[model samples]
Target: MAAKSSQTMTIPTDAELVQAQADLWRHSLSYLTPMALSCAIQLGIPTAIHRFGGAASLPDLVTTLSLPPSKAPFLSRLLRLLSTTGVLASNEAGIYSLVPLSYLLVDGVRIDGDASQTALVLAVTSWHYMEAAMGLADWFKKDIAQPVPSPFEEVHGAALFEESMAVLDPECDKLFNEALAAHDHMGIGTVLRECHALFSGLQSLTDCCGGDGTTARSIVKAYPHIKCNVLDLPKVVDKNPSDGLVNYVTGDMFHSIPPAQAVMLKLVLHFWSDEDCINILAQCKKAIPCREAGGKVIIIDIVVDSSSGQMFETQLLMDVAMMVYTRGRQRDENEWSSIFAKAGFSDYKIVKKLGARGVIEVYP
Candidate 1:
């Protein structure tokens, strides 16, 4: 026999092994939870509960939902899963109630008309989104030194925006726009509410890559004295009606931006690489007055905070989401500083009160 081996493998204890396996299984099956939520949305569970005085027993939910008798037990199981997952509330007597989170799924409920379809679309698990997610493994295996497109591009053979505009799926496009509107509403709401001081002195502002004038309209609505302009591609601008409160101008942001005292790029930089962002910022710099004339770039995006546990996790999740969808990322303050420096911005300030995101004022 060979020389006696001194090394021995340390095996996990039975309980440890069992717990590990359970955790793995739980993670593996976690996809089912979102799928179940999607199914519930499809079955009008949120609407049913809302219509039933915000809480309904199984039989009452079945009646309100118009479900067949045979599916009651199965629906009950689904509800139990949703309740356990905190999507809804369930009492000891088997009644289901809508939570603030679940209430987002009810259409026509939002007065501001900024309610999101993302929750519903994500729950239904859009094929394009799912395909990109499934491609993550192959994406990781690619050479780290080599250039790469986003996982979404690797799957669909085009960037997310390019694919969305080129594709012929009307329903998908509508849902996507609604989802975008919802997200924009939330982010812009935060900026306009918490960062009003940033926009107060500026007379004219341009929203580069602004979609349907959502951000611009919100800004003008709050501060009517500030003239707002939105610059986007021709296709996006052609679809929306001209709101008297905001001007929608059609153009490519890479080549040019509308001249303004301040340029607001709300959630725009996160979709591009640093190089691309530098190019865009260069164009933005040219479009605005000098720093003494109240010229600056207002960026509303995630500034990753690693100090907080849950916020850090959410920021990382957004980073992965950006990886799957685009060549961008959720930047930390240092990364943002680096990008700003490269883009010829002399100084910047950050206001981090907007939940997981911040308003970064970049001066030229």
Candidate 2:
């Protein structure tokens, strides 16, 4: 046993307490940083800079981005903050250049006036989605067990899916659907390149809730021998053209999934609760064959882990999105295991090829 001392604890000085308060206040204002990025994206700053041979002076940017003379000073300040925060790079002469981070915001080579899919995702997150997060504390004060829907429902008066289906906001629906397609363009392409072996043996695959058939199209293009089908809601499938490359089926994944050799649920599981996810997985199991027949559910979503720095931060941020917009979550390995076990999956394998995300294969 150690002897106890009568020493008094040191008290913080007034200056120390004031400095701590300042630090807290600084963190509180950090939202302005992302808001600045959103503003830049809205103003087409990234594309402007890229068009200027990857570097542009403030005046050149103001002209290229078509900012009015009145907003030039404010735009300068925004760029300075973005550069200082390492979202972009600035040279000694105050010329701005695109960094790897800002490059994702650039319009794709096939630009049609919309923001890049990645940029659209960022913009949407900062808009109504973030407004929902702002109400989280107040939402938590309610009796959560009473089917609160989500924090999004607390603010918007409806769940996100319901609102999207209702077409209450046409602009929001367009943005959300386009963002999903863009995300699939970037993420699914990377997954296919990294894990081509996963799709090798499957003769037929169904991309459940696959919007616009981007994933199915990509898969069919890469492996023409394997037939791919996209199953989504009637309204969503109705908009997709009969491209002849892939078949589009109108249905709900909760009730049933069209029969296929394998079921591919890209970015779907994270948008539902445990019970809903289990139900959906059971449907997937029913749609596919036994493990010996090469049937499995392929999931592309974030797996929360603390081992990586940026990836862990990304997963935490996405978890907050799920909390705010839906009754879902970014699950850790154990949470995923529980869901898979509950869904009657005998085994699962996680392919950590996608940065900040993973490909999970669940076998029935």
Candidate 3:
């Protein structure tokens, strides 16, 4: 009877222990944390407190957010998690104060054109990211098990570029464009400071995939001679400029890009698979003059394994993001070189050690 009980035991044996250890990944899946965070931002919890004259007590927060009396304990638990993340601060008496990150939640914080929060909201719940999250486990596997069976293919049943057109609801487009520009602003600031030489001898530059002209405007401000143009979809330019400096041109980069001494393609190529990148690059090659005329493509993107420093986990997170959103894959130096060659480019130089990104000068 004792032996039979031992044989039927529910507790793990040594092999089962190893299997359970491997399966512990289910606990490690913490994306729900950020999803919850996004929900808070969407609910304008921080903005409500700001309107309430800042520093909110627990009871005050409950009232402001209008929680039911029955869920009071659960609401406190949520607040505790937000506090632990430094998104919201707690006073000595346990009243919560808004932090810098929370300030992003306030709609009218930027008198000019601060679009950071809008982008954040779009990025978190975007279909691209949702599809990628659906394929997260497939990223770990060595082989794709089916025809056109990439993790992205599995989720979207199509390529990234296809979905870009499919995701054409007006509200979503606004959020996505806002996020794109806000993200570019951060990347361009770092690129301008670190890779200034890449811009040398270029009389004008066009940000081909630049949404709403954030990076181009910054460039035109910094270098008065370097006239900048922002080329994007018709919808992107539809809203008349509120406060951007560079002129906006509605066009497609795949067929034609505006003429420039050098074209800046930041965070664009990674959205396309290599074939599509080649198509875009071939157009870029046509848009500019030869290298002697300072004709080149200034690419600010990740060359994933370039012997650089610590990558923000966001970088790797985005690689999987590309896999789901488009057929694109983030490349290392070798992979980038291959794409350049495929695009009929001669040579390229990479300069790393920038802020969480790499700057590459690709010559045609």
Candidate 4:
């Protein structure tokens, strides 16, 4: 009787078998989500629906997108998939409408030029990124002692920051830059508005590794009295000439940062390893004044926390993306504290949470 009971327990129940199959299918087919999203964005489906008063029927989308009558069925299937994925909404009457997510994809919806997330989506879904993602499994199988820094480097034969993409495809480089600038604009705008106290008395600030002076220009716009200097590579600063408001300085962050009351490293440190981050922070410490003089380093990056539901999930996704593209990983609070202490920072404070990221103020 005991043996028979054990055998019965070993056999999977009907419900357990069905659930296991469902879980396997869901995980296997997860790649289709991004592919479908990319296709919808490329086809300008969001813009088309927006043009039709943010709600459109099947025939309306066909006419607006200039699809042939024969392709109407396929378009319907695409819309149905998008709706199921929560990218859009559909009613029993077959009318489709834009949800919050689709609004960012509509052309001209953002007042700030090129500040929408559309370019970012396109850049991430581009061929190079997809190629790198496909190579991640094989990259894991390689010897750990191998010098292949990341899956992207393994696939592309060069690091992401080595200007390999720019050399190989100028258009991709431009798109990626645009995406970064857009994200900077959105993030900095929020920080300035919500955390005004952080920059209240700053007289001079340096934007370390600032790309094309986007963050500097925004800071100058918000606080005209603060003298903003952007430090970056010659290739970046040369193209973006000083607008006479923000000073553009051509230099490397690893060696030195221009003197300032405060130094800002927005989305810069995460691309490097922990040791490299410490070195960069040391440079930042050298650039600022004593803590008593309101000198600090402002960092805007992800602070991974499991308590935050969707934001935590997004952070994890970005952490893996970093693993694939760079040698960096998003740090939790304890990890960040360890790095700060090692870098000779006297103290640090997480001022606020900005979506999936956070504002960290490190004092000398």
Maximum-lDDT candidate: 4
Model 1 ranges with Cα > 4 A deviation: 1-10, 118-120, 142-147, 163-171
lDDT of 4 by residue, 136-219 (tens): 999999886734489987888766656887887788778887776666666687788899988889999999998888778878
Tens digit of lDDT per residue, candidate 1, span 87-200? 999999988898987887776567355563545455237777788899999988887553568887788776656655347455655565566667766656656667768988
| lDDT comparing candidate 2 with the true structure | 0.82
Better of 1 and 4 by TM-score: 4
Please name the candidate that would achieve the greatest TM-score relative to the true structure: 4
Order of quality (TM-score): 4, 1, 2, 3
Candidate 2: segments with Cα more than 4 A from true spot? 1-19, 68-73, 110-115, 118-127, 144-146, 163-168
lDDT by residue (tens digit), candidate 3, 218-297: 78777878878888888667764846468788999988999998888988888777788889989999988899988999
What local lDDT does model 1 show for residue 344? 89
- In model 4, which runs have C-alpha deviations exceeding 4 angstroms? 1-12, 111-113, 144-148
- Winner by lDDT between candidate 4 and candidate 2: 4
Model 1 scores a TM of: 0.89
What is each predicted model's overall lDDT from 0 to 1?
0.82, 0.82, 0.73, 0.88
lDDT of 4 at 84: 97
Ranking by lDDT: 4, 2, 1, 3
Q: In candidate 1, which residue pairs clash?
A: none
